[model samples]
Target: MRQDHASCNISVGSADLDLDGYGNIMAQSQQIFDCGEPLALDIDEKILLHGTSWKNANSIVCEGFDNRMCQNAFYGAGVYFACAACKSHQYTCNQHKKCCSCKCQRTVIIARVALGDSYVATETRKKERRPPVRSGSSGTYDSIVVKPGLIKGHHKPNQVHQEYVIFDREQAYPAFVVEYTL
Candidate 1:
């Protein structure tokens, strides 16, 4: 629950958290108006994990995810989560060298992600900036899924492990911050 990293001079801004929470609430509320009635709970919502440096983890919990800050866009310019802990653990590198003497403790966030409709991705979509627009529809796919399987004629899969990505920040809620040492 404690999302702040005081030693790194990073504190969760109440306004930031409140504003993001409010926006998500409003978005969900609008669905009722758009559909003219309340809808059933989304089946795609999932509990997923995301790993990052301790500093970045604080920012994500406080300000919410900003895909623009994504360093790797292998799947797309979106926030990445994984069903497998080891997949997310690949990203828990300490980028803030000066902030920590030893990078023993790693951080991973447990998030509630609304993965609504997912599009399975091909290696060709590696540079995609966002989810592909749905065929013959104005709305885009809600998320992207990259699985571990070789494309025909290819030697290996573009990804070794599965990854899930959501382009919209509101689709994810940082529910827990877990710190552990390997």
Candidate 2:
């Protein structure tokens, strides 16, 4: 059924609308407004909302399911830098600020030298003369040349010195070097 009216009269109380946390208006009443109708409301209303002022926000913290939703920011020097989680290390230059690059090491023998293993030598032995003199006589000694004794000694021995290079993961070039004596 259709009713013909010259003008439509309606009254909306203060309870008709609800304001959300951000002060956005939410309609509560089911009053329908027809096209080409002069509408009327009853009360003058203003609602308080939240997070409307920029000065109220303190810290920048964002979280989301995927990488597209969350934003990590470095707020400093009046600069609000916002970036995705994947690119945060590059944006903040944190990748270059490393404490130690090398996590593993490998030892390699660079050089080895060999010296004389053993040597033989000779010595002079002093022999005392026959002591037949009485209590007042001093004993005379004679120097005799002796054959080379079986003296055993070693010279500058061969040594195995190793030079080690440290690397991180599969890095092609070494980060540092360490020397070891074996």
Candidate 3:
């Protein structure tokens, strides 16, 4: 039996009713909602019950699986902007607050590329003019170049760069170009 609360909130859980073999409600109690606050639930994953809170919260981190039980949110200009890294299925347009309508991860990728993939290349080479302090640190170094591509010997973590046009000494810009940077 489905009982509507004050609004559209439909509370269901072990405390709300006693379920029998035939999916029948055998009893009712004072408690409601598997957990009072928002939560994530996985199949074959057990959730210990008490009053209105979860006994084992597991972790605050939200893996791909945890996103299922919660509503999807876009990159908002609120507290979400404070995060060092926030991956949403929606593009984060700083200039405009309008969120691009997207369905899956690929949609987000296309949106991101359209919004900020220009001046960006995915492949880079670090030609060592001279050997490094270590022995095996010379020759051409291959790297996945991000924006503002690093040169001969200047690369750091979390540093973005802008990629310019391509040029080959004696041939075209290579036979193929593969981009995989994010």
Clashing pairs in 3: 147-161, 147-162, 148-161, 148-162
Model 3 TM-score relative to the real fold: 0.14
What's the CA RMSD of model 1 in angstroms?
14.3
Indicate the residue-level lDDT of 61 in model 2: 14
Query: lDDT per residue, candidate 2, 1-182, as tens digits?
Result: 00111122222222212211123222321122112222222221211111101111111111111112123211111111111111111222213322223332222211111100101112111121221222232321111111122312312232111111101111111111222221
- The CA lDDT of each predicted structure is 0.64, 0.17, 0.19
lDDT of 1 by residue, 59-174 (tens): 99899977888764567688988766666777776854222435478888877766766777766455778899766444567778766655333346444566778988987888
Over the stretch 1-182, how does candidate 3's per-residue lDDT look in tens digits? Answer: 11222132323222111121123222221122223422222111111111000111112112111212222222111111010112221223332233443232221111000010111223332332211221232221111112433333334543232211111111111111112212
Q: Whose lDDT is higher: candidate 1's or candidate 3's? A: 1
Ranking the candidates on TM-score from highest down gives 1, 3, 2
Highest lDDT against the true fold, candidate: 1
